[model samples]
Target: MLDAMIDDDHTAVRASTQDGTYPRPQLLRSAWTDLCGTWSFAYDDADEGIASGWSSAGVSERDIVVPFPPESSASGVGDTGMHRVVWYSRDLTTADLAGAGHAAGRRLLLNFGAVDYRCDVWVDGQLAGSHEGGHTPFALDITGSAREGARIVVRAEDDPLDISQPRGKQDWREHPHAIWYHRTTGIWQPVWLESVPAVHITALRWTADPRAGIVTADIELSVRPTTGTEATISLSFDGRELAAVSAVATDRETTVVIPIAELRNGQSYEELLWSPENPRLLDAEVRVGDDVVYSYLGIRTAHVARGRFWLNDRPYYVRSVLNQGYWPESHLAAPSAEALRDEAELIRSLGFNATRVHQKFEDPRFLLAADQLGLLVWGEAPGTYTFTPTAIERTTREWLEVVRRDMSHPSIVTWVPLNESWGVQHIAADPRMQHFARSLVSLTKALDPTRPVVSNDGWEQVDTDVVAIHDYEWRPDVVRQRYATDADIRRLIDSVGPAGRALILSGDVSEAPVMLTEFGGISFDTSAADGAWGYSSATSPDDFAERFEGLMAAVHASEALAGFCYTQLADTLQETNGLVTDERTPKIPVDRIRAAIVGHHAN
Candidate 1:
């Protein structure tokens, strides 16, 4: 139903990246085949698959849908128990490869949007590749082994009780409890195959400096180019050519800076600048050898200026909601690409310009939706529950990959490396934890200096650009009085915060941009489940509206705050504190909820 609300251009982009279509929006190629359907699945709980030669002679215990975890109902294999090792096998016909444009001189690449924890890919009984990290994309070249009737076998190992791994809100318990939801094990995203030339483009990155009229294009190739190999990059907007540049590529990677004359005009450049008000995207066509990539970029910048969040060099208010990005049916994997686009539109309809993708590196399709719909995003990494060397190493390694994979998206305005000190719980006095947090912030900044980085969000902050606090004071008067002035906010910052921990464990955040990142989690579910709850509760719809309006009014009128993010966008499992239900139906009317968010009156 939300699809009808999207405009013609947005609808076009949404339709192109639908489920079983192109999963990667940042770097898209036409020659691709969706590998999402029924796959033979088996659980290797006894961990005897490797010794039993399951990869060579695949096991078929049951059939499960590709891209949905076995723990989810959508997968048709709703096994929620602890099955550390799971195997998936699918046969690819020669027709599939040929349809994907595979040829003699081309490379046939198997890609996974994401597979939880760790996985090993076997093509026709030969190990093709292996990847760790549940939240990032990976590809394997199966050109040599993949043939007619080739059997592709995948084994995924995800320890359900591994608190050291960054699992986000996935409950380590056998059953869902509290705010944590059911586990998402094994392949929880799209799987596809792509064919390209041997020396094809592997990755594409875009960095836009709207004020300088320059856009930097970094292109990575499958292999280093020959002596005279060249790459051409063309940029266009609204059916008009803006800039084009070609450069010789002798190495695997090549960087080109193209200046757009239209973006240089001080008076009319605003038309081209990307913002929540104008989500104009510049089209890009990149060519390297016989390979081509179709991509796009938004000319925008995000920074903190004078203790205020600035977008495109102008101060902007961030009305955001904490979106955990969960579904009752599919868990982490979205029901469809159309559902992801509809999500952004729904958030925008409620009058929020941004969403804090809480505790998870969301699917790229959601980020694509945010980009297309002018909805800002705060990209965050899923946190580990325990602090250990493995935890630190794993968190750091995956966080870097997350940043690199998503840095080019203009919708992401901030990067939160740590949240609520999940892994580094004793960061207040532990030097190692503090150092790790600081290092994550520094590393994020080193990688992407364009966006503000939150070293640790919520409380126990060390060094952060945004002083984000999570205060769920249900009393509207207390909320209004606490953040009513600069002095009050500073006092709260210096002392214990709403989360009962020191807001600032180390720095002088006197000048940092302040925001109430989390609050107003009022539970009001008419058909509440057994464990459904919230930080606060409202009895009826009228009571819910009153409490929501009161808290929002105080937050919106606060002069000391740069922005605020409500507890959630939609209900996630037992967490019934969402503006909308898990089905995405607003508990209150859409217009009234929008009025509460933007300080406007409902008709």
Candidate 2:
């Protein structure tokens, strides 16, 4: 384990590195020794000028855990209710970087899993770099500025009022009652240091086209020198080497394409397609001189055509639940990789083929698990209340980051920009908002021509490819009345039509390919016994079972209905109306839900 320094009062940072290793575990590689662990933390109120200084008094204030935000109880700082600016400082020595045969390089990369809103980083009192956006990961190269043993200080400011930045579900208020929750400030995810050469691979974009039987690898180098550098890319499926190409890296961009057929040696030539049922992945290795980077990707294609969503050209049903990716212990962060995998497996066991990651962007590990486990995903930005020009620009930037990072995963099929008119007031009526929504959809479509883009889900019907709605009326009879007769269903569908709107519903529906995007308000034993539908009351176990049966019966009986996702897989904080408990423990037993969803036994 790597030795770390925190405030004198706090214990040494618990190094998550496995057996003093470096380079750390990426998405596909699952191991216990991966860099995931405890770090020292201190909160600073911007009103007070403690974050800018590095005095002994600033270091002795208090300590919390790293990766996990202060609001979460798991971080040992249970809900301070402080949404103001805060700073975190820690120390790492050269000895910490040296492990086994690995030596500290000239360039030291300080990596942050994620930070909320905006952040500025410093090493040895010198400014390292700064980054914006709350959900995505960013890093800074602190090679020249640091000493043999250096102090790393990070200051982060988050004004949830700043609607320009993408903040998924973080409300500025002290307490969050409805669909929103408390703001998660500074260092919510993991922070670590790595040694990398000055000239190394900064980023790589991997795209696999199974239909064309070709995989295109785009490599981005850190520096473009006068003399070009060559990268040797080795492509392999399973364990056998397919193709090896050494390509010259230009200042702009470099691409290398390899045919799948060339790798198949007398084997049956079947196109490798990634889907909820079958998620096949290929291993890839990129070597720049002696430094090597290993990664994996799945080959799949997704599109919407003729009012049907297709994967690999086959009509695929996206039976999905709205996953906000929040935990009672970690707030917006997942406690562990195991926790992420558990959610994916639970969703699959419940007969859900996909998940709508509502309003929030998820960690890379979550998407990696989904891709490996064969779960389709609908990704979206966090909901906001403002849509100013500045807001649109910032949102567009963050949305692009979301797309760039998650594009390689085959599980992600739909790119959803707006949700339920949270940002667009009167989304249905405001022509400007509607036009902006249409433009966003067009932008997403232009970015990734393969996937379907849903512009404004469940509210304004813009020029998007899919027409989605979120109707959560309580009464079952009323729900049935809206979609019972063809004329009624047609009228409901016609309400949002110029034409070509693939009607997708959140509640009960009687139309073909109708999605129950939201339903099932059954709570667990811990929920309060109120008549309200949210986290307040726990329906009687018998009543809960009855309602589940009734909903399944209604959905299966309607031939027009394609698929439905339960309200949620697990209960989020204050949202007790979930199929599973807050801790991801089953509320009504998994076998029962599986029987209802997969068996299709109508009551």
Give one digit per residue, the lDDT tens place, for model 1 in 231-296.
Answer: 998887765678888999989979899998988889999898888788888777788988887778
Candidate 1 residue-wise lDDT at 163: 95
Model 2: CA > 4 A from native: 1-40, 50-52, 55-58, 99-106, 225-228, 262-271, 475-489, 496-514, 522-525, 529-538, 599-603
lDDT of 2 at 580: 77
Candidate 1's C-alpha runs over 4 A off are 1-20, 600-603
TM-scores of the models, in the given order? 0.96, 0.86
477-524, model 2: which lDDT tens digit per residue? Answer: 555565554465567675653123334323223323334456555555
In model 1, the Cα lDDT at residue 486 comes to: 85
TM-score quality measure for candidate 2: 0.86
